[model samples]
Target chain A: MAYTQPHPRLSVVSNSSHSSVDHLSPTTTSRFSLPSVPSLHSSITTTKPGPNRPNIYDRPLNKTRSAEVSASAFAFLFSEVVQYTQKRVSGINDLERQLNTLGYRLGTRALELMVWRAEGSSKAPKRELKLLSVLMMVHTQVWKAVFGKGADALERSVENPDEYMIIDNDPLIERHISVPRDMSQLSCSSFTAGIVEAVLDGLSFPARVTSHNTPTVQYPNRTTILIKLEKSVLEREELLK
Target chain B: MAIFSLWVINKAGGLVYQRSFADGLAALTSNEYLVLAGTLHGIHAITSRLSPIGSSSGVQVIEGETFKMNILLTVTGTKFVLITSIKDPTADSVLQKVYDIYADAVMKNPFHTPEMPIRSEGFDSRIGTLIGTGQT
Candidate 1:
């Protein structure tokens, strides 16, 4: 279920607003209240419609259709996208950044969709409080939704508590992309890193995601996404505990 | 009637891939395959430009006595060519399915570079299975 508890401060402020109105209705002591209900109603109905707009949240995702798409269609579209983005970029880094930005937007929406989907199932969608739980969710649920399979591994840095790694033997986004020798440093998996960053950021876990080429014997395109959490988040995490 | 083979040509008219599903078609040298791909690309480009009706740059079908070739070109110029026995009606759908797999196994593969030859064993085996060939 969605987080239903209102903040303590929010309730205090709303009650004060109701009290101010209550003073005016002292003569009629029936005590009828329409305080927070109207505001909630307005927020729900405020979504405006445009002719070609498709709202992702309006209806439940079609179970069978929502999860899969023609990979060829996606590849062709992604190729054109890379080509289009490439024209304006001065270097490989810039191109990768642009692609990351594209993936970031997708990640934000995907998180919402995934959370919504999770709610429809038996398990209650939990707030990402624990670091391990969040990483597990990303490594399993998020990875599966985006790539059609779970990431191969999730591990914490032995040297640093703030650093985490999500490894995929074969990242799907890099399937067609072969970086040139000159741009060997470039990893198109940055788009996927952007997705990971956005997902963590969505849950207020500020972190940097960098994709590294870790070629294993079995997984040549083996990608390890390093997540470095912000100091503030680590501090807050400690306080929460 | 059955589908026999599939070919993928990049926008530059280079043959990136070619696979034979059935044994009747004549085998050519790898260089010959490249020439065939390049020639087809040139002809397709010229046909689109020379269309009397204008702006229709698509090559839909090419019929031979024994085989029919169906071509599906993406908006970005990647062409999928499927050759089949003349009476096979499912060539278009098969090509479309192959296109989807290409996007997945090759395009999405990080090791695969655009406009480069596909060497991914995953793509090879998937296609092999799809076309009823046990061999990858």
Candidate 2:
């Protein structure tokens, strides 16, 4: 793509034979160069073609293709993402945060697709209203649809009314990931947590989802993702319940 | 007399996958097939070592009375073997296509742990269609 420099139009008047005779002289060289004139309003204008794909806003975001992708390919790509995030950050927290941010974006789109796919040929699933119902949807339907298995368990926190827990014996995203010894405290499962958080936030439930590695003798890679709802969410839940 | 079966042996001489597409031949138990795969792997290594010239390119084909088996060893040491009727002329190319599909369907699948049994539905359906097309 050639980018033309913005230059004011130059107008030149030539005196034919008389100017031709004077053009040879050193003093007349100035005639060839146009004086720099200030452009009126300085409109640096160029036409760029509109994007080839249809405008994102103009198209409905609900369509989904029933396609399967190789899990190994996804694992390799995800590993590279972790490496890339690791290179940019100084510490584990920063890396985990970047991964969470990436997962958050994916979660927003995945939630839409999951809801559409699950609702089937009929109208979309009724907007998930109650807190417990949405949590059930995620634990059973969404988790199974995404991972090919329902999450191992879902339990409400007995100590705190606003807190909930979703447990997975083995999360698919971290199946191939073996974190180094130094970053043992770091669980990349935050990415999946971010996804859960996005789904909840999309349903208007403000919550923070964090991953905890509470491994047991049986389930070595067991993960318990804690979802802490905002104070207003509990109040609203009480009203709705 | 058509495409009969296929086997995928991992680098370590373990049978990772086996599928029979046609029925005329007698079927072996899963353990017997595993033993057969290990035996073929040993023969491949032995023959490569016994090549008179310095070149030990390994086993490429085996022709019996009724069936022909073609082998294609990938650079990564994954072996793809195709068993077909003696008349099938393009067995090598079919095995090549099988290798390509394996790379895509088995290797690329994130759920597939290395050297595990190959059970991807995509892989199975693609192979089925491929062999079906080969017959007609």
Candidate whose TM-score is highest: 1
Stretches of candidate 1 above 4 Å error? Answer: A1-58, A62-66, B1-136
Question: Per-residue CA lDDT of candidate 2, range A176-208, in tens?
Answer: 554545677888888888888888888889899
Where model 2 places Cα greater than 4 Å from the true spot, the runs are: A1-66, A118-120, B1-136
Candidate 1 lDDT for residue A157: 95
Best by lDDT: 1
A20 Cα displacement, candidate 1 (Å): 70
lDDT, residue B127, model 1: 83
- Under CAPRI classification, how is model 1 graded? incorrect
What is the lDDT for A78 in model 1? 76
Candidates' C-alpha lDDT: 0.81, 0.78
Report the C-alpha lDDT of model 1 over B1-136, residue by residue, as the tens digit: 7777889999999999998888767888999989988998988988888777858866789999998889899888999898888888788788888887887777765456789887776687678878774122
Shares of reference contacts reproduced by the candidates, in order, are 0.33, 0.00
